[model samples]
Target: MNLRANERLSERIMPRPHRRFIFSTLLLCTWLFIAGCAVDQKAEVDLYRRVLDGRVAATQPYVEGESLTLVRAMTLANQHNEQLGLRGEDYLQSLIAKNRAVANFLPTVSFQPSFTIEQRARDGAPSGSTGSNTTASGGSYQDSGKISYRTEAPIVGSMNLFRGGGDIANLQSADANIERQRLLLLDAQSTILLNVAQVYLQVLRSERAVEVLRNSVSLQEARLKDVKDQFANQLATKLAVAQTQAQVNGTRATLLQAQSDVRNGRHTLALLVGVDTINGKLSEQSVTDAVSDPKHTLTDYEQMALDRREDFAAARAAVVSARAQVDAAFAQYYPSVSLNVAGFLYREFYADASKWNAVLLANVPIFSAGVIEADVRSAWSRLRQAMLNESFVRRQVLNDVRTAFENLDAADRKTAEFEQQVQAAKEALDQARAAFANQLAINLDVLVAQDQVLNSELQLTGVRFDRAVFLLDLTRAIGVLPEVTMQAATRPATLPGLP
Candidate 1:
């Protein structure tokens, strides 16, 4: 009985011809709201998943205070890195912008209830007549001073059928922007990876440098002591002892500087991994291959980078988005159509403007004081800027690949030269030791030959370190650092052009 009464009340309140419109509009709005919420929820899930991964990565299998690996550093950075987290927020913002663009192509519903008051019939007939207007013959008795009021409560809904392609363009632009942010995050990841690896390797390299210089200092000290002993025996000159002391001082100075570099490298690594300090031994891992040669040719690397580089792809997407904006701006020159409907719940002093009303509104732009023209021109300017950026990024991608490829080749060549130098130094050192054992050469000659051999090996090691850094650079330039390293900087691509 209650349900039937409610039906009759609804039918009486809104004409049967339009009652379904009210229910359908409500459902549409509800669905749209739910969809928007779902989009937000999805973005949240994605962002925090990386955060979780970073936390989990911190729990490594290595013994505490023993080593910090590249994998561990990257995972921790992905979570704790403020800059990357901020970029993730940018991704969320783009999602929201897309939501706003979507709303343009959807309907809106609102409830408005209002009350009004008015003064009526205040004119007096002949001021001296004295209340004659309030006589029995007077109608409505306005001279007696009365008030009038009105009330209306309505549920309104509106939907845009067409405007310009601006809605779709804005949507496309938002989609492109999302890709751009994601690619930027990936690029940042690769860059941070390079920095961490460099710093980590540098710390180890500087430590090795310190060790080498310390050994040289020790050798010089021993030689200086021998020179002092011989001078006391009147076998060596005082000048020889002074020169050996000078050599020891110089080597010690260099060793001090190398130790400083090691400390600085540790500080940099700590900062890069988003920690206050890296408080432990860093396990060494070689990032180089035994045979350092590009599987692909130089030309191939250049072309491949243009395709694989995330930033370059992002720049291209920006151009597509900007072009869409141009079309959207042109859309403003066209007419727009919309539908507005209202269902009045109750009314006072509005019996004639009764239960329901609807208006199909169309706005034709005959003139706008050059506003649309200005908009179109501005959009075109933006498109031109995007195109220019895309070109610069394309060249940059090619250059990165070419530069790393060439540098690796040079390092490889240096490797050969340094190896030969080391071999020759070792042969000389052997001859010096043999000659000294036979009493044919002085102790100073043997010390000098050993120093030369040590320096040669150090140079060879340096060449190998340079080869490793260049190999890592080539990996980064190709935009596969995360992939080849087995660490993820981003999720799967969301758009068509992204790979």
Candidate 2:
């Protein structure tokens, strides 16, 4: 009986132990897999950070002047203006031309050496006295003047003259071109900065919109739960409950769209900030202020354009360049005077010694097949075109200024109106909620109030964002942005006309 009992115990205990061991092994493998996954996730996160170096770098250095706002980001982009490979290539080419221009003003020198060797003999006798006295019958004057030597020396100098100032004009043109590129680079920087700011602001607005929408959804969800509870208690009708549920579902769908907008806005910001095209994170400003409307006088705006706009300066420079080109064209009609100097040493085997010769020359062009006339015509046409373009840009800039100011004034008023609307809507929602709590209003009434509140919130957000956008446009129109070495974006303290 004891042996039988022991066998039974062993059978049960051995199977149980094997099962426990297998289970433990499986759990261990699973844990290893989860741990490995966590490590990989961390690595991917780090890789994304590395890819968005520009955005990350923008926020670093512990924050300096103006806290490195989006405006400063624009300035930074300008300072770090890079256009794929074109800008660098342009810079390099300009540098080469500049170096060549500098070299042209310096002296030019060269070295040359020539030698002549030959074996010669006169038919009867050599031209010298000794050769004439030699016997000619001795095997056809066996005196072969086989002389060979090398002349080792060099001569070098330089000369400059009045060539209708063509070289000067060329150098001037190069300098102007460099200036033009510099201005263009400034313009590029401004554009990139504007893009970054716009995208960054969009992301901020989208995020806020998402948060506000989420709050709305939560509020609706709470109302839906209350309506369901009331319907169960027969205090609220089924229709009212169904309406609340439908509203909640609709809010959820809208929430999804807002989230998508946020994601896309962040992606756009990443692209503008030079963030890697791959996976990257976007950092944005956290601003919660009422958008304000500001008005600027026309005179002030025009002054701002003249003083701070790089485009205006560039246009003016173009006019100067056109005038210079006209001068260069006219200069072609004049004669060019160039002084030339050349020196050489000549050596011959037949001569007793080497000979040296030096010469100076002057040249002028007295006639041409109307090439100068054609050039003058081209230059005049260019000048006229440039003048027209300048006028057009100026008019456009002034119009932009006027439009921006008007928009700013309008945005401020709209923001104020919307702010009032939002406040009234909030009050209405509160009253409806209170009435429903007291059983004086149905669930449908409360849901409608909630929807109104949500709509008002959305409207308010849009108005605020538009105000900001208009402000940016106004600043740009006045050309105050590019002239600003640093950015100081002033967030308004309160809504216009708000207490």
Which clashing pairs does model 2 show? none
List model 1 lDDT by residue over 1-499, tens digit each.
Answer: 9999998655434445344544565677788779866645675848634633432343433333657765666656655667776766776677778889999998998876554434433554443232213223322221212333344568899999998777888898888987887777677777877787777778877878887887777777877887799889987777767766776787788788988888889888877778777768766654443223436777767766787888998898889889888989999988999999999875542454458889999999999999999999999999999999999988888888888989889998999999999899889988987886687887667667867877887787787777778877887787766565543222222111223
Query: In order, what lDDT does every prediction score?
Result: 0.71, 0.60
Measured over all alpha carbons after superposition, the RMSD of each candidate to the real structure, in angstroms, is 9.7, 25.0
Q: Which candidate's lDDT is highest? A: 1
Q: lDDT (0-100) at residue 323 of candidate 2?
A: 69
Cα lDDT tens digits, model 2, 404-472, are: 778777887988988998899889989998998998987778888888888888888887777676676
TM, every model: 0.79, 0.69
Candidate with maximal TM-score: 1
What is candidate 1's local distance difference test score? Answer: 0.71
In model 2, which runs have C-alpha deviations exceeding 4 angstroms? Answer: 1-72, 79-81, 84-106, 111-160, 277-296, 342-367, 482-499
